[model samples]
Target chain A: MHMLLNTDQSLTQRSEHALKDSFLRQAVQFTTERLREKKEESTNALGDWELWRERGRQIRAHTIQYLDYYLDQFATNVEQAGGQVYFAKDGVEAAKIALEIAKEKRAKKVVKSKSMVTEEVEINTVFEKEGIACVETDLGEYIVQLAKQTPSHIIIPAIHQTREQIAQLFSAEQGKAVSTDTKALTAFARQKLREAFAQAEIGMTGCNFAIAESGSVVLFSNEGNIRMVTTLPKTQIVMMGMERMVPTWEDLEVMANLLPRSATGQKLTAYMSILTGPKRSDEKDGPEELHIIIVDNGRSKQLGDPKFQAILHCIRCGACLNVCPVYRQIGGHAYGSVYPGPIGAVLSPLLNPEDEQVQELADASSLCGACYDACPVQIPLHDMLVYLRERRVKTQGGIEKVAFRGYSAIFRHQATFQWMMKTLRHVQKWSVKDGSRWSSFLSRLPIVQGWVRSRRLPYSTQRSFREQWKMLQKELEEGVDNQ
Target chain B: MNREAFLLHLAKQLGRPEIRNPPKREQIGAPDHWKSFVLPRKSERVDRFCQEARTLGAEVHCFETQQQLQEGLQALLTSLKPQSILRWDHTECPAMIDSVLNRWKSRIVDPIADPSQALHADVGITTVDFAIADTGTLVLCSDEQKSRGVSLFPAHHIAIVDADQIRTRMGEVLAEFRGGKPPSAIHFITGPSRSSDIENDLSIGVHGPAVLHILVKV
Candidate 1:
């Protein structure tokens, strides 16, 4: 069910490749660091940041809890507002619906702002195969598209590429050498995409929050590309996740406050446009036909499952990415999915449950819980990752299962546990002099090999906890006699 | 798939039957302190707005009187010396503002009638329905007279903002849309269109206006 990324390489193999790229490591570190600092400063300014996070979590929880009620209300309102609504059961259907609209409209070109849902659906690929030119109007998305790659970062899609690589990509497109100057490169894209905007007959966008009451699709962007897309095209297509909803405009204020702050730490993006259906019958601009496609790939599968339902509350803020240790080490490409970082680690497997490749992403994290702390909606992603691993373990087994079987055997009785701990401590005292030096030897061990390859762990202290406790009790009795 | 099937799937996954009605929330929107918080005085808000707007790379000018405003607008337009300008015809906009554009009336042809002309127009000037001082945002609602394109389609954008319309936060302005249908398009323009996407290098005015000058009349 994975659409864009070539999943030929396993998640570990992909991550291994990412780790070898020094440039990717540094770029991920720098980019996440910058965003993290900005988020810290902005959140501190709010003075009770946790309270806002809780509020955001509550809002999402409530909305998802009564999703059936709200989505129906939203669909009805969108119809009343003169916008057609489509409910897509999966990515393929969502992309097909979009292509059908383009074909029906006889559109030659479709200009698009960056929408991850489109990536999830591989809509651009579908359009291209249908002979409809789909242009990514967001600069980052444009760069990635020109390079023929998936976005590495969610918001800053081309975060993995350097200025030189970007320049080369742009130069090839323009049939001339484009400079590495930020200003010049931006000017080139501006001119290049402006032409696309004017020439395209259909526009596509992702809804940030679909207000249930007004049936308006709110889009927030710093680049104003969304405004151009929605306004320039005659027919507009908005592909959104089913959970991307708020009860009303009043609730939108909460999201409006939380999303931008969590994303880039801005009070607001440069433009926050709320479009309620198509342009009015008498109005001069905006889309003449608005289509809202609500896609539920595998989101409904987690509905009643209490452990996973909160995962639906994610706002796609990318805050968790900045704090995720694994994500910082290996950029988004390593995740091998549309949604990346902690959210992606949990989400990808759920979205494509039968794919074992996505299931391997569960082991990608150390379960540090930084993602949980950073999450605006407080989705316990770390817990979900463990849950995913637990689910997968039932269906499969290897060293982990074997090692845990041994672990359970020893722990079932105090005598076995004591014997094992004593034996291990004796071995540790004899051979565990330098952890890093001996780690490679430890890596050769059959059961603990996977655990020790990446980290250096000495076996134990010279004395076990039981031995130390006995010694302490003897000393205490002797000291009392002296007193 | 049809809507009922999709929704029924959700209901089944939720372990319940489909629902059409739910209890209303007692309160929706921002937290109490956030919604209630405001700058101490108009002067502070004005100062804060100018600082925030300038921080976002938008030029801001404040005038104490219509006389000062006219001179300021005239000087600003004169410096721009645009070949053509697109101004939204809004009654909410002061007549003096239109009178000022009348000075350059020949440049104010109805570009909206022609999409190419609208795209090529040198400048777009329109009246903001409301303004948020906290984030230095302008709220523009669309109608027949006030096309959303008037603020979007140009390389340079200027906004006519009434100082009295400035609220402390975005929640305040969003609160007004509680009972009625909002306009087809409501644009909250915070600053010149910008992006930090290319190698963390900021390039302002990418797809929308590169330069935005907000004239706040006191």
Candidate 2:
């Protein structure tokens, strides 16, 4: 997480690094564009997409409203199924529990499936510090791990890596020449991961949805790493965001419809595994001992709060990221958190409130409502981004506060508003350079620069729309009087 | 660790204000229009649905007579060359099929026999009580003959569904579950065990079955 910190390197500097790499830019753009196209095609294929979104929203809202009941029921079921449940208040506590579990197991090696929660808690770095070997088993995760880099996209972790770079990574791992061919590269990854799956002392995964009634953590994945992770290892630990719960198997059908279609435009995930408590007494292949860590880590704080509560409904589909202009251009690295996109813009700031590192993340959205349109659950992420910005202003003692104050002052007095408009008309000349306007100057000026860098004002009309409307209305009224 | 303390902690995290019972939700699952989607005859619909399921990568077989179903089972059992097979609790399948399999040194047992044992078995045979035509989902309820782990865990899973049991919508089968929650476990299987994890490479059979054969009997 410290790598995410060091605001000394702002999103601009990081995005600049990503932009300069032609391969990285092409790869990210290709994947995001392909994913966006798939989403459009799939949503159109599924008639009444809006109805599905609404049903999804209804279930999420209902489940969140009664989270306590559902979470308790889920916990009871997991326990009854012979799984231990631990509720962590925050990342520190979550990491602490993970470290303790590792120590208790005397585990020298751990194989992990792709889990954003693990990244949030910085578990790999923690294990590294403890001198435990942690290997990422997911193919995308393996590429990033080889590069000593964090995941750049939510669903496609190595979206930034080109085929050439992957070949290079694999070549170095093998200490021999490796082909850049996709099949050969993938086969290499399979061989490497198959070894890790066989030998790892502990297997860890993220929970997609936990069925409270059945004490089952449902995992949806295209890769079979999660299955191998849960079944082959002796001990399996599932780290679930506290809100990743549904009332029953009945609710799972709704989520099943929404998640895969939203994530990758699949009719259904290739493998959807429901693990009910470690291995039952009669079970042969599943984990012998199962531990489910319900990590709150700033999620419970959103409960009942009307303004930001709907943010919890996110199934982490990555559809929002694919459609987001900011994510499409700057890529996920700029967000510098486990999550990225419109969802990340709100989630990161909310999760790490007041941490100067993520405070500016809320400004990354264009708020065009494209994300809301793309969301399977219809979470109004654009509105949530605004709420995060509002909350940030409410808490800060500096430029954000002064910026809002100046904004409010302009609107409070009509004279000041008109004066500011006139001043901005004269001041706007310098911004228009050779017909293409320069926006970076406006952003670099002060605290609000992040917003300016991402958006451009089309050449301002000769008169304000409000002024034109008033004049037209006045003329119409006078003509009527004359008649 | 203590139940009372855990409950208190969980309750507090829920923002322990006075308990307010929220309104009961009516709108859940697929929309009403989807639930109302019905096909023509069960036999013809089952044939079309099985074909569709096969198109999505599941192996499908249609049997006209009970003897034909037994013949198909015999052929599959001989080809697999397994020492043991797991059978689900269902009356439609020939009772002698179990003894016949046992004679081949492939002993048959009830569906719920431990998953580990199921994993080691050559094949698992169960009669799917219900199937959905739309998404190619088979609904398995826990009973004396059917164990949740049979269709899953094993190298090969053979499911038999009476043609009349096939439905058009997934909801119709889920409603059967609502009547009294049949067992601790219920599974909806759509297609073959598949994975696209390694660079989007599609591989069949990772942890679950390598082959799934569904026999539709009229």
Which numbered prediction scores highest in TM-score against the true structure? Answer: 1
Off by over 4 Å in 2: A1-8, A102-106, A171-180, A397-400, A423-483, B1-23, B38-40, B66-130, B138-167, B172-189, B192-218
Clashing residue pairs, backbone N/CA/C < 3 A, model 1: B205-B210
**Where is the poorest 10-residue window by lDDT in model 2 chain A?**
A431-440
Instruction: Give per-residue lDDT, candidate 1, residue B16.
Output: 85
Q: Least lDDT summed over 10 consecutive residues: which range in candidate 1 chain A? A: A432-441
Superposed by TM-score, candidate 1 places the C-alpha of residue A450 at a distance from the truth, in angstroms, of 3.5
Model 1, docking class: medium
| DockQ of all predictions against the true structure, Cα-based | 0.80, 0.24
| Candidate 2 per-residue C-alpha lDDT over A1-483 given as tens digits, one digit per residue, 9 for 90 to 100 | 232554668766777876787766676687788777877777787688888889889989988877777777778778887889998877778888888888898988899988888888888988989998889877778889999988888788887777778899899999997897766776677667767776777999998998766778888765556766776677888888888998776778778878888887766664666677665555434577888888877776677678878888989888999989888888888788778888888888888775876878888887899999999998998988888778776876677688778899899988889889877876775655323455545656664465456655545647877789999999999999999
Q: Quantify all predictions' global Cα lDDT against the true fold.
A: 0.88, 0.75
Q: Which TM-score does chain B of candidate 1 obtain?
A: 0.94
Off by over 4 Å in 1: A3-5, A427-443, B24-27, B39-44
Model 1, clash count?
1
Error of 2 at A412 (Å): 3.0
